[model samples]
Target: MAADPAIRAIAALDDELRRGMYEFIRDARRPVTRDEAAAAVGISRKLAAFHLDKLVAAGVLHATFQRATGLRRVGRAPKVYEPTGGDIRVSLPPRQYDLLAGILLDAVLAAGADEGARDAAVRTARERGHEIGADHRRRTRPGRLGAERALTIATGLLESHGFAPARDSPRCVRLRNCPFHPLAERAPDTVCAINHAFLDGLLDGLDARSVTARLAPQAGECCVRLTATT
Candidate 1:
């Protein structure tokens, strides 16, 4: 599938220090010194300092200097750096698409095991899907929530299940991609069951109901469309 342009842009950052600094901040939690990052990545302190400065300029990291309290020292202390309160930095881990692809292919094989196997597999998938959706709904439910709140609740549910949700203007919640689309193409009913249970759990959690999802008929196509019904 062609990547979403936005996602592609994000992936493009992998070739630069932005990516490294992002990982540094994400892993370190606290701010780190240039020498620390340099040693960690086997780069020179000057190079690390240069890239760290760029990150600070990008508003992704913050800089602070602390002077030592030593009575004999006359020079200013070095700057200590840390991440700013902002976007959670992003970095791609080693691609594990093989594991995900294997699980999906296994779903297809499991469905083909017997005449009733498809339905059985779908039931299990639905239950698991619903369990995930229910958990996320509980976590993200707004205070004083109502049916109007189901939109956010349902989007969060789908996102938690590895579906990338996007808004098509205001009227539609377009599922940009599905991790299971390949398996779904072979087993539409199974996919539908999963979507139904997911939405059902999300809406139920928000004290809301009335959602519809339809699977598109091809691999890599959007398989879920969720929206408030009312």
Candidate 2:
């Protein structure tokens, strides 16, 4: 199997010269040319170009050819490099702490009260889950979802969120992975509550009337489980 693209991209920065050049281009107010990057890292222009191209291939930098002042020049314009606009992350088993932190911070800012932050976070999580459920329902057009249909939709949605849901029975699904992970371990009550409410909202929005979100905490499993009501 091939190496993960993200891991390869991150590993490319391990070289001393390449790391220096990357930082120079990233902090530059404008895109940098091969000459400027070479001087910044004390390397030859040819060597700088070689490393820069490697970075580009790794998706760490973007390359473009343009005149220094964005005007037409008599000679061929210099190739400029800049940091890629998006972030690159690599994690085995895939924990998304950045996403969780953003949600919490957004809730805190929106609520503007310390006491209400948790409540806000729960509401935000539920609303997001509801929107996802509603969107999935619209796209799939599975009208009046029965227990099996609801399980299928639920499993897909959970899997997309990194829950690793598996069907335990026709009426119950077991989630093997927790996207929140250690945070859930550190703050079980709050995190578990938010997860429950989120799943509840998802079921509601999905119109999976035969299913209900229930807290059935088990070792090495998600805090909430979806079960058939009848």
Question: What local distance difference test score does each model get?
Answer: 0.58, 0.86
Q: List the residue pairs that clash in candidate 2.
A: none
Q: Clash number for model 1?
A: 1
Off by over 4 Å in 1: 1-44, 52-120, 140-147, 156-176, 186-189, 212-220, 227-230
Q: Please, what are the lDDT tens digits per residue for candidate 1 over residues 1-230? A: 65443354355444566577667766887757777777777789998888777766656567887653554656765776776665433323112233344434556666644536445545445544455556655676555544445566667756544567776645457776655555556766765565555445444545555554544433454566766565
Best by TM-score: 2
What TM-score, computed on C-alpha atoms, does each candidate reach? 0.45, 0.78
Number of clashes recorded per candidate: 1, 0
TM for candidate 2 is: 0.78
Q: How close is candidate 1 to the true structure, as a TM-score?
A: 0.45
Q: Over the stretch 78-150, how does candidate 2's per-residue lDDT look in tens digits?
A: 8999998778887666666765676687677777555576799888777767887998889888989899889
Instruction: For model 1, state the Cα shift of residue 36 in Å.
Output: 9.1
Taking every candidate in turn, the Cα RMSD to the unseen true structure, in Å, is: 8.4, 3.4
Whole-model lDDT, model 1: 0.58
